[model samples]
Target: MTAELKLALIHSPTEPAQEAAKVLRDRYEWVPIEQATMAVALGGDGFLLQTLHGMLDRRRILPVFGMNLGTVGFLMNEWSPDLLENRIERAKTFTVTPLRMEIVTVDGESVSYPAINEVSLLRETRQTAKLEVLVNDRVVMPELVCDGVLVSTPAGSTAYNLSAQGPILPLDSALIALTPISPFRPRRWRGAILPERTRIMFRVLDPVKRPVSAVADQREVRDVATVAVAIDRASSLTLLFDPEHALDDRITMEQFAV
Candidate 1:
C-alpha cells in the first residue's frame, strides 16, 4: 500500500526539520506535492497548520501525516525515522472542517479567510472592544465588552479556546465554542457552545473609537466593522495519526490534565 501511494514531503525551515527532511529524503522517494495523494509533514503544530492551509489555498486537499520536530507538537505524531511506512499504514484518520471568516473592514473592504483553529476578534488598543453578538442574524448579546472574543471549532477547542476557559468539545460533538477573553460587563458570562451549523456574526461597536481587529488563525484584518464565521464543511481536511496516539484521544486526555 505504501509503495502504491505517492507521498510528498513538506517540512518547516527550522534546522531540526531540515535535518529530519534530509534523512527522510535519502531513505524514501518523494514526488512533487501537486502529484501526491498523501503528504508527510515535519515540524510542530504550527507547521502542520501551514501545510494544511497551503493545501486549502491551492484547492488540492491531501491527507497529511505530521511528525513532531518543534515544541508542543499537539497536532503531530511522535518522530520516528524508521518504520515510517508501517506507521502510516496503521495510522488512524481524522477529518476536520475549517471555519470560513468573512470580514468587512472599516474601509468597506470585504475579505475572506479560512481558520482551522479559531477566529478571534481582539481590541486594537487599550480600550475594550464593544461588539454585538448575533447568531443567525438574530441579536443574542446586544453588547459584549471585553478584551476580545473567539469562535472555535471542536478541532480547535483545545487550543486558544481552552486557554480562554472554553469547554472542551469532543471530536464528534458537532458543537463549537464561543469564548470571551476578558469580559468587563456581563461579568458572569463565561461563554457558550453552539451547534456547528450556527452562523456567528460580531459587529464591532464604535469602530473608530474602540477599533477591533479580526484574525482567522494566522491571517489578520485590522479595523474590522463586522465579521462572520461559519464552518466550511465542504473544505474539510484529513489528518492521519498513529493509532495509539490519535487526535481524539489526545483531546480527551487534555480534560484530565492537571
Candidate 2:
C-alpha cells in the first residue's frame, strides 16, 4: 500500500538536499503537503525539526521519514534515491511527545511555544541568573544561582542535556530531565529525572539584575519572569526510520558512545 498512500516530498534548501530532491522527484510522484498521508523530509536533524514544527503550526501532523543531507543527522536515515516507497513501507515508527513551554515576561507579556527537544532558560547578561524551582506548585528549591536551567524530554536528553552532563533517557522512558546549566549555589546539586506528567516551573529571582531568556527549541523569549514546562501529549508527533537505524535503537546506542 504505499501506492495508495499519498506522499509529500520536503527538502531543505541546501545543495545536497536540493540535488537529492531532483532525483527523487523524477522517480516518484508527490502530492502537496496538505494532501499527503506521509512525508519524506530531506536534510539533517535541524531541518527535520523544522518540518515537524511546521506541521505542528499547521495542525497537520504526518508521519515523516527523514534522510540525512546535513551534519549530525541524528534524526535522519541514510539517504538514497532508489526504492523510497519500499523503504517507507518497511520503516519503523516512533511516537514523540513534545514539551510545551509557557512563559511570562517582566513586562507581563505571556507567550507559549512547543519544544520537541528541550526548553532552556539562559542568563541574558554576565550576571548569573537566580531561579526558584517548583514541581506541581510546590517549591523545591527556594534559590538556585546558575548560568541557566533546562527541562528536556527523553528525545532531547542526548542533545544539550547530555552536553550539560544530564542523564540520557531511553526514548520510551516517559521521563524528563531537569538540568542546571552551571550551578553556583547548592553547587553539588546536579539534576533530576521526573515523571513525564509532572509540571515543572522556574521563577526568576532577580529579573532586573540577572535577566534571563527562555528558549523553546529554536524559539526564544527574552526577560522571562516565570516559565512552566510539561509534556504535551495532545501534540504528539510520529517519525519513521529504517528498521536497522530506528531512533530508539540510536538512543540506546548513545549510552555506550565513547
Candidate 3:
C-alpha cells in the first residue's frame, strides 16, 4: 500500500517561492488547498500571515509548515527538500488562539474579525489617538494619549508588539500583552500582561478630533469609534515545526540573543 499523504502548497510571489513550488511538485502529490491535512507555506512572515488569515476566513484549521522565501523567516524553517517527510513526521504541534476584534465605526457600522496576532487601534491622522481603555468591563486607563494601542497574543508579541516595546512571552504561557505605541500621556506606563481570558475595550475619546482605525491582522476598519478585543481559545490555529526547532526554544533564544 502506498503511503497516502495529501499536501497543499502556498507560496509568496517571490523568486524563491516559485523555485520551491517546482521542487514540491516533483516530490509529492499536490492536493487542492481546501482538502489537505498539511500545508507548506513558502514565504517570509508576511506570507505566512496571509496564509493563516486565508485559512481562517475559510473556517478551516490545518497544521502549517513555513519555509523562508521572504525577508524575515522568524516563523519559518530552513527550506530543504531532502528531509521533508522526516520533518513533517517529527514536527511539534503548538496551538495558538486568535484574538477577536469588534469595532463600531463612526457611521454606526459594526464589524468584527479575528486576529492571529493582535488587534491594534491606530490614530488615523497626525493628532494622537485619545482613548479610554477598559479591561473586563472596568476602566483601567481613563485616558490614553498615544499614537496607538495593541493587544497581542504570545505568538504575535514578537511582531508589531516587539517594535512597540512589548515583552516577549513564551508560546505556552497563557497571557496577553497590552502595549501602547508612542504614548504621549501616561509617560511612565509601558504596557501590561493580562490574563488570557480578559476582554479589552478601547473607546476613542473624541472621534472628530482624534480619528482612529482598528486592524485585525490584515483586516482593517477605518474611523472606528470603539473597539473590543478578546482571545478566542475555543477556536484555535495550530502550527507545526520540526521537533528540534520547537517554538519554545526559538522564543527563548530570541530573548537572550537580543
What's the lDDT for all of these models?
Answer: 0.95, 0.95, 0.89
lDDT of 2: 0.95
lDDT of 3 by residue, 46-123 (tens): 889888888888888788988888886888888887768778877888898999999899999999899988899999
Residue-level lDDT tens digits of model 1 in 3-31: 58899999999999999999999999899
lDDT of 1: 0.95
Model 3 residue 25 lDDT score: 83
| Model 3, position 117: C-alpha lDDT score | 86
Q: Highest lDDT among the candidates is held by which one? A: 2
Instruction: Show the lowest summed lDDT stretch of 10 residues, model 1.
Output: 1-10
CA shift at 148, candidate 2, in angstroms?
0.6
